[model samples]
Target: MSLDMSLEIEGEIPDWEALDNAIRSVGVINYEIDRDYVFQGAFKKSDGYFWLSKRSEAQRKTVIAEGNHGCSFCVYNAIVFRINNFYYDDFVEDMNSFLKKLTSLSSMQFVLSFQYEDVYAVRNKRGFEFFWDQPR
Candidate 1:
């Protein structure tokens, strides 16, 4: 299952490399094309992108997305914030601001992501915006 924030920026992401580098301290930006080569007889995956934070505890954070060369829907290409944990907050926060900073240049929209944790029959809502400082 793929998931992330509901907000995102589309079109040419300015200074994409620099932006990727800036967030390295939190997580890594992985373009699908860079890895996962197709077998000689297999078909190559289309252009898509996404990233994940190294696992620290029992869980890991990720954003399965697409860029200009990809279709709009795949994973939660529209990253919102947080999964079911708070430790992943910083990365979410940083990306939030990063996208916010680019709002003027790219076409992006932040939408509400409904999340819930199930404890048997009860569902606990743990919704909040998570973030980190963007490297200067």
Candidate 2:
């Protein structure tokens, strides 16, 4: 089974080296660098999996209005990961670990959005997806 995963992080500009280190720690099959984004190669266990990481700066005023909840100073981060046949438990565990590491480094709440595709399903509709908004 192959799964595609994308991870986005917003808030607090990350040091490229630090970010790279954190991702490399995942022990994925392959990875590529493109500007501020990183793309990972497919995993045999996750043949159809695709992962993406991206970052964006937030508006300063939105930060002030939201107070600490606003990562205005921190870049707007978002991650989207798509999984094909992997089990939910395994995926969640991996994501939890990644989120923990990100939070520790930024010292600010991080938001997460997860989406999954059903390769076996007959419907063409999008797969399962979930999201959580974190505090600043």
Candidate 3:
């Protein structure tokens, strides 16, 4: 079983340095790239980079994605990141901090969607907040 979190932010993507720093707040990244590491000073969208978290033993990857992506919900014109398969026990807190750090980099609002096991949740700055929703 894996945990996945997606962050959707409006407008242009933040610079790679800022994104790197914010991601490091949760764990140390392995940073695997082959000439695709940076793009116009921002993270190259849809690329997945592997990482290791200090809080968990599991190894995982985080992907910089583009456009709107939610299973049931929708967020448009956003720069997205999909942090995948992190089994940290205190992940919810870490995600909250991650979102806060990202929000600080720019004035754009953020939308976050997370899933673990049977639970799925969405948290956003511009309203549309919801707790766990288990599928029927």
Task: Indicate the residue-level lDDT of 11 in model 3.
Answer: 33
Whole-model lDDT, model 3? 0.38
Give the alpha carbon lDDT tens digit for every residue of 4-40 in model 2. 3433333445444554554455444666656745655
In model 1, the clashing pairs are 4-80, 5-78, 5-79, 5-80, 6-79, 6-80, 93-130, 93-131, 94-132
Which regions of candidate 2 fall more than 4 Å away from where they truly are? 1-8, 11-13, 34-36, 42-50, 53-77, 115-136
Best by TM-score: 2
Q: How many steric overlaps are in each model, in order? A: 9, 28, 1
Query: Candidate 1's residue-wise lDDT over 1-136, tens digit each?
Result: 4333333322222234433433332333332222222111101121112332222333322322321112232122222333333334443454454444443333332222322111001101222233222210
Q: How many collisions between residues are there in candidate 1?
A: 9
Compute each candidate's TM-score over C-alphas: 0.29, 0.48, 0.42
The Cα RMSD of model 1 versus the native structure comes to 14.7
- Give the best candidate by lDDT: 2
Candidate lDDT scores, in order, read 0.29, 0.40, 0.38
lDDT of 1 at 19: 33
Whichever of 2 and 3 has more TM-score, that candidate is 2
